[model samples]
Target: MNLYPINAGNFKLDGGAMFGVVPKSLWQRTNPADANNMIDIAARCLLIEYGNRLILIDTGMGDKQSDKFFGYYYLWGNDTIDKSLKKYGFHRHDITDVFMTHLHFDHCGGSIQWNKDRTGYEPAFKNARFWSNKDHWKWATQPNKREKASFLKENILPMEESGQLNFTGLPELDVLKNSALGFDIFFANGHTDKQMIPMINYNGKTICFMADLLPTAGHLPIPFVMGYDTRPLLTLDEKEKFLQMAVNNNYYLFLEHDAHNEIITVKNTEKGVRLQEVFNCNEVFNLI
Candidate 1:
């Protein structure tokens, strides 16, 4: 199997929101914020090439939102999913599967796009099957007060309307093997209900797509949960278990939102799990 890091786009989010109650003075050591108190965020999606299938892990926030909507995120950089795919001799239409970690706008927004005349929204990848768990599909469609804004209707629904939406079978425990996307999924709910973390076996290493579970290396600490999480306390427990497993199994964490560090490993330190080392896609998987 081959893997590539597809940078859909880059933007900034409030540091406090990203790091939760963690003081700026502390988080700034790793994730330095701008004067606006915003930290760099990457809509870093992963592309998997297996057999004849070209599976895109998640599409970044698509370019369908209005200018005013994008102004809030402070988007930067010239990267787009099409450009990133083309860099590796692929295109958006080549994607056969789109496995979203969750239904958040930033994660799945790129899955849908505006039609030619801008009359209605449609699936961005016409030939791909969109994958999200049944539970998350419901939660996102019937969003709660806390996540209503993050789960935009335009970013979703279109997949189902496109008649390409498929629900992966939920695992009774921590891991769901042989998912529709052909990878094990680690189910996490602290950030959102049934957030699927893809665990891909690549080049003799377990590469875990760390969605919001550990957005960046700075989030290695257990208490550094995001303020956006619906259940911060639940996140604490989930992180404790997942981090311990990562250390024990030596999983290569593929960070989706960390702008600085692309891939990293965690080791058990005196203080708890901490960043072991940072690696490039070339050094780790020889993506090029």
Candidate 2:
């Protein structure tokens, strides 16, 4: 199996919102903000080449939203899924599985796109089976008021409408041993309901798609939760357990939202689980 970091693009999010209750004095050290107080963010999607299946995890937000809508999140990079795939000598049509970590627009928006002629939407990966768990599918489709905006209909419904959507079934547990994607899945609900984190074993090491469970190296502090989380207290607990496990196993965390830090490892310090080392994508994955 081969792994590639498919950078969808870079954008900005409010530093305050990204770091939750943590004061800027702390967060700014790792994620400095612009004059407008927005911090750099990346939609660093992951692509896996496993035998005959090319799997993509968590597509960045697509370009279909209006300029006015995108004005909120200041976009800042030239990277796109098409461009990223081309870099690795692949294409969207080559993807056999599009596994979503969650249904938030930024995480799954690129799964669907405006069809030819722009009359309506359709699955972007014509040959891919879009993957989302049953609980998350239901929660995203019938989203709560707090998360309604993040779960955009245009970014989601078309996968099902196009008959490419598939639900992954796993028994109730914190970790599902061998999921439909041929990797273990860590179920996290603190950020969003039933968000799946993939634990991929490659070359005698484990690479975890950290998603929002551990967004960046700066989020190592247990209390450093996002304002977007539905239940901050629940996030605190989930993070504590997850970080401890990460430190114990020495998993290579492949960050999806951290613009600067592509991957990191954690160590149990006197304070708590702290950033052990930071690595670029090429250093860890040996890009195709």
Candidate 3:
């Protein structure tokens, strides 16, 4: 199997929100904020090439949202989903599966696009089955007041309408969970309800799509939880446990939001679990 780092683009998010209660004095050293207090974030996605299947993990914020809506995030970058796919000699139609980590706009917006005449929404990957959990599908469709803003209907609703929506819901052990996509789903609830983190076993190593669990290397510290999470304390517990397992197993974390650091390893430090090393995706690929 071959994996490609797809650059869906970049955007800005509030530094304080990204770092939660962590003091600016600490996080700013790694991820500096702009005058508006926004830090650059990459909408990185993963492209998996296996036999007769090309699975894409998460679609970055699409260009369908209104200018006013997008202005809030301050989107910027030279790379795009289309350009990245072309780099690997493929197109949207070539994608057989779109494994969404969650229904957040930045992660799944590019799955759908504006229809002809720009009057309605349509599936961007016409032939791809958009994969999301049944529980997350329900939660996002009936979003809460807190997360309502992030669950844009335009980014969703199109997959089911296109008849390409599927689920890997709460799989039972000993079963080939994501046999369709060729990965095991690690469900975590601290970030959002039943958010699926794909654990891809490639060339004797496990490359975990970190999603929002460990947004960046800077967020390796247990206390660096995102303020947007509904349960911050739950996140702390999850991070502590996950980080320990990652450190012990030498799993390569594929960061989704970090602009600079793409992949990192964890190590046990005197303070706690800390980032052991930082490297680009190719560095891990070379190890493979």
TM-score of 2: 0.98
Root-mean-square deviation of candidate 3: 1.9
Candidate 3 stretches with Cα past 4 Å from truth are 171-179, 286-288
- How well does model 1 score by local distance difference test? 0.93
Candidate that beats the other on TM-score, 2 or 3, i.e. the better one: 2
Ranked candidates (TM-score, high to low): 1, 2, 3
Query: Candidate 2 local accuracy as lDDT?
Result: 0.92
Q: Which candidate achieves the best lDDT against the true structure?
A: 1
TM-score of candidate 3 relative to the true fold: 0.96
**Alpha carbon lDDT of residue 244, candidate 2?**
89
